[model samples]
Target chain A: MNRKKLLSGVLAVCIAAATALTSAACAKKNNKDSGGDTAEVKKLFVDLHTLMPSASENATPDQPHPVNASRYIAAAYKSLTGTEIVWASDYAKPTDNINNISAWFNQQINIKNCPAIGFTFGTKMQADGLYADLGEYLERPNPYVAGNTRWKDIFEDWVWDDPAVTDANGKIVSVPIVLHPGSATAIYYNKDMFAENGMTVPTTWNEFIKTIDDGKKVPGIKYPYVPYTGDTGISLSSWAFRYSLSPGFAAHMADRTDYDKNGIVSTNELIRAVLEGAFNPNVCQEAKALYRLAYNYYKTVLPGGWESITDTTYLNAWDEGKVAMKNQGLWYYTNEKSDVIRKFDFDLFAPPVAQSDSSAYASDLPRKKLSEGYRSQVLISFNVMLPAVSGNEKLLEKAIDFLMYLSAPEAVTAMVQENGAGLPAVKGAEYPSVYDDSAWLDREFTEIGISEWPLGFIEGNTANINAAFSDWVFGEKTEAEFFTIVNREQVNGARTMVNNMKINTAGWNI
Target chain B: MKDGKKRKIQIKYIIAAALVSVFSLFYLFDFLWAKTYKVEVVSVSDENPVASNGERVEIAVRVTHFGKPANGHVIFALPSDGRMLAFTTLTDENGVATLTYIPYTANAFLPVHDVEIRIRDQSNSIFWEINAYTDLELKMRAR
Candidate 1:
């Protein structure tokens, strides 16, 4: 009986000891998880890219006035969360090599030290599982925001529905913080030069061409229309021309090309459409007319050495009053207004619409209107994303909290006011007063129903597209020859994309 | 002998239960009661008295809380436009955070202009404002 009592006592002691040890272990873990007593402030690495000021510019205060929008954001976030943001050193310099950034991010991911927040151009990284699935978190109320039911409620429904921010599985992978009315491209004309030439802003394609023709006769104007073609990717002019004119050519093909029926044609869907014989730029009359009309317009307005001039050269020429009109993004309006040394006044107008009389393929679609409330072509900017490879759930939670703070209406207003890049994506966030004089804000935008860039189908195909277009423009390749080369390349690119993505071809009917 | 052994066993059980209770209380205390401080900004001043447009001027801000310097607190220097002039910096041991600022030329005709220097805390809940005059013509000649 004594032995039995001793055994029971021993068992009770063991159970109690185990329970105590478990509680102690959990307490230690909870402390570390909450970072309750840690003296060191946690750090989250980020790459805000062009959305932030260059470190070199900001580091050396003697340089040109630097904008510290991202710094303010970081400071605000740290104040709230006690987490410091370490920006990537090379965040300001733009690189055409998307792979380099992707590779660096992947390497960081492997080492488990990936940046918590960064920008991405497309959903490729999201598909590779590099970006965290933000759908569930977005559905939950943002803790930092007061009276917010869902985090996604901060953004407009159109922005949240954009496929660019969502993956193939319809999971939200990125947060777009800025939206601009119409496409980013606009025609910036010299106000003085326009008045001197007695030409008003063109409302139709014919009128636009005529205005350019008239501007060419002006003595000092070296190039009447200077469209930036320096980028190895699609040039500003090329993108504008193709997208603006696409509706006239391919509006009828939307039913077949827009596989998901989202109104916007995705790159994958465009490839599939080409493979399935739904859109053949070479054979289809409307498609053929698109390239021909776009090419002809370029030939008319562009100078002889237009292909050789870089964006800097074109911008310098415009500033020097040598270029009468320049095609640029809406963000340039802020830049031009802020230039202290700028001597000439400038104004912007939307790309003129193509009337039915301009071509048989023209759809006679009324020019799309632009307003603070009605944004037709919503350009998603600053797509901030979280790295999925960061296995620390606590760190992820902190990063998400920082993001929530950034997406708040007040924070977004501050960001927009500092960056002066685009309109705020979050509701209740006010845009800068600089946009008060923006004529394009109330004018009609060049309507684009189906966006198509046929010259380059794959990543490295830009060179071929540029070359072919250059040769064709320089009278080296006939229109037919240009179409043939581009058509074959398009098919190969579609095939490559299909193979790489392992895209299901079950219902493609290809 | 058995009764004595049972009493000893009962004593062991009480000790074990006491230890568990102590541990549980400790865990709860650590989880529920952690220290947090309310930080605030104290003052802002221009370190350089004479400055010109396009020349880097040093702006310093002092931050403190409850009669003590708030070390490692982040502060920002901004222009009248409310855009930050430089990246944020943490307060040093003296509770002073300094940043470099270059005044921009608003107009060539009006060479001298007043620049409003706004200092903000990490939360931007409090602000301290100061002003400095910059000569654009002098800066232009120096350049």
Candidate 2:
């Protein structure tokens, strides 16, 4: 009886295997008969990062939905090609740590079930050969876009040179979908609170400080000013403060550091300048004055326990009338409007300039008018990339096709409107009326384009740099102690970057 | 013959005892580890009754579980009107989550709007499948 049972089990296994093979063959034959394009590329898995809504939301037009750009873009793609988008539900959630998401994508790419299309915050993945080079494809015409000869022609010229989308080898590894034309960061203040204090929008650093001091006197306000103390890296508040002040102090270093003679300063050039002793944060009086001014301003306005506040907490405080003013990216305008329960009236203003009265280091240069040269710290938004790990040629082609469709003017406008963030990167796309404020148009005076400078060195050391600055500002460490720690870290960070990128620094007479 | 029969009986008893131990472990694991959690929406209130278009109206919600406040949970609030955007916020230590809503277009008169609120875990998974609602009046034009 045991022998017979074993034989039957073996026979069943053999029959199952045969049936699977036959079914696969039949399906392939049927696909060929029906024009196999659809069969080969039935679905594409995508992770649009923060641009798309959460899959768990199950958002639809029938209900009050957050702008579901992924759904809208998917529908348009489906109409153009008979393919479906399987939104990568398990990857790149808005709340997930960006570093973790990038690491997860790197690991997932080795598996068979990796997403065909995804996004990365930096170009490290492209450097690792994880993303497909789109240089050739960009030269091809986008069929969906009317009168477009080349796909790359649709975007702003600066986008091609932006280090975020392009790799060091000059390969286009990612597509730029959005651009921040003017000031990316601003102060969102409570209009009612300002009115009660008889305060008007401040254009100079002294006026801004006075507004904060006055707002502190109000009975209901717990924190008169809350600069976003969230992530240790370049945050909304810190970036705004650094760039707005750095121009007045560090603008003189621009001509010496911009090695390539390009209008903008690249990471390598800044690193080289640091090594050559052209710019030193440890001893330079201008640099010291910049930090001193910033420290004093933050020390005066920031409330106790401010160091513990994240973006969410600060925004919550602002919504609850606990905060009178908070620094945030322009994206918060649409974000605030979408809130169904926000009770206070609020408006945005540019970060006030540090005038000569505030500091001797401050330049008397006029604020730069709206121009293409003065771009946001985040040069590009919605950085879509095609991962090479998917390995299927047909699937990758379909992914690229869908990206082309998204790049068209109509689709780009829809996405920008839904995102409520930066302006459109593509020309001919309609500018969202929500970002029409004139305050965002005029740039800061002596606005040095290298906003991240010494503070934003190699990615690994940025957190330490930010922490040391926070410690000094919050009274945990003295100014001298803070400078000692940051100076060493910044030099080491620049050296590490130089070595990793194999930058040729022999020309520099260090 | 008696010894052989005794050995067989001993083997059968060993097998039965092992099976019983495994079953008990399974039962204990279920009872001690997988306890079910309950979430309740205590209240949803409108902070502003006389809000207008382009002006913000505050919406607040309090969540609890078995009479204890739930902290750090996420709440997604959506207005009944499909044109306006939905908002999400986190409940504080006191189990309260508040967000500000503003209408884009103005109306001639004040209109009552109902907001649908859903509570979820920090990872964004729905905890209470059922949604709660609150109503408020907005003038739809600046006063």
Candidate 3:
């Protein structure tokens, strides 16, 4: 009996020790305090791929990441909302295919529990069911929320209130977060060169081309103007198309209920004009000449390897007095900071309007006063999702509050503080103090701000535009062939994608 | 005294100490490697603001380390002035600009427009205010 009792005691002790250890190990696994577990404040991951990759680790304030605007948003969230937001530069891998970002997002962010917010180019962010309806969160009656003028009115008109656009169930799904307005399509010129050369700022299309050719003849001047067509591939083409159809394209696209409608009033007409003016070699003979002049200038005027030179290189060439005029985006100044700007004055003008008349530049002088319009990028309400598994309501609320704070007047100002670098989506938000006191405020922030366009269609057609432009640039297809391909193939492809996705196909009927 | 156990404990202590030292050294190297650069803005033009004959313009700029300029090429571009009236120039070691005139009328130049300027390198970049130095208000006076 004594031997048996001793044996039983030892077995009980062993079992108890094992049970205690197993419980302890499980507890350690559940511990949120350690970096390894998820139970503590669940970590939400954000991937900011819109910026170029940085090789640096400890990205500082002054020497902040190249995408400091995004970093500023993250930092501001931590300070204003008091939420712990951590972001890793390496969160996105090389092969993170943007096409199926919804699936990629589901895998990387583990949206079943933690909520996350981020900015991406239009194509990737629009993938299906990757977001939650932020309408209720955005419309809540907080004063700070209501006072943010930028989005208050814009949301109803452009963002959530669009009748044509609907989510998976035909409900509003994604919210506009950061908008990059189409780089305003305008003509950039050298004032000193124009004056000295007796060149009038070309107001009509004929005059503009004549002015360019005329400027080429002036003694010692390289060329009156050089569009950086060689440096920027589709961007130059996009600029060309916009200038060709600027006056009526927006309205036609905006009210485009019947996609196949004809005449100058139709979107197809505008698209056709762009196709002919840009891609139709026979029609755009003059346009092609303009493009050739631009490319030739890049080859002859720009130093060293013109093909490898960046946008800034051509811009610097302009600054160095190597070229006379460059047709480019407004960010040209913000992108290339050279003292040449001070030495020589430059100005923005609407591209000379095209006309059917032979003396287009002569009689159509009044129409020339109308400059090109700006394309807008907006900051719409960001989408925040509560994982069905982690359904942590507290975390959801915190993220919503963070967005609210970001939309606040003060916060908008803080973000816009980086002048020419960014603008806010908040409507009626006072111009940033940088602009508040300056005369250029309207031109820099207001006039240049990205305006909302037909969002869904724009997002859908981005790839088609890319492919079409690529083929046209490398001469794989003639301009007319390219246009037909873009219209019939690209736009039609987009229409098919929308139909397959069960998206509304009214405006794309053509 | 129990010599065997004592010797074993001493060995363990030495191992822990060496491990800690390695980690500290690793951290020190990373911190040193990530040191911030003292980026200074240099002029790309031979003149702070170059003069022009109303036609051709040229300018130059460079990046330097410890007062010795780096050999990398740099850019100097002009901002738009509403009328597309301005041209830009790229710079070499010392930025210089020259402009010849085609003799347009006097109303061409707008007064007091703002010029935008920017520069960048491998690690960091800088944006400068150049209107602080040059006048953008010059008008095309009829010769």
Best by lDDT: 2
Tens-digit lDDT string for candidate 2 (A341-452): 4677887777776657577766543556546354443444333344432435566677788788877876776666556567778877755444543345554433444423
Listed per model in order, the count of residue pairs whose N, CA or C atoms clash below 3 Å is 0, 13, 80
TM-score, structure 2 vs. true: 0.64
TM-score against native, each model: 0.65, 0.64, 0.52
Interface RMSD of each: 14.3, 9.3, 15.8
List-wise, what DockQ does each model earn?
0.02, 0.09, 0.06
Q: Candidate 3, after superposition: displacement of residue A377 in Å? A: 4.6
Query: How displaced is residue A413 in candidate 2, in Å?
Result: 1.3
Docking class of 3: incorrect
Best by DockQ: 2
Candidate 3 chain B: worst-modelled 10 consecutive residues by lDDT: B100-109
2 against 3, candidate with superior DockQ: 2
Q: Candidate 3, A297: how far from true, in Å? A: 14
Candidate 3 local accuracy as lDDT? 0.41
State the lDDT of candidate 1 residue by residue for A363-456, as single tens digits: 6655656544454434443333454325456666665776787778766665665555577788877665445546556676655544444444
Candidate 3 positional error at A244, Å? 6.2
Cα RMSD, each candidate: 21.3, 12.2, 16.0
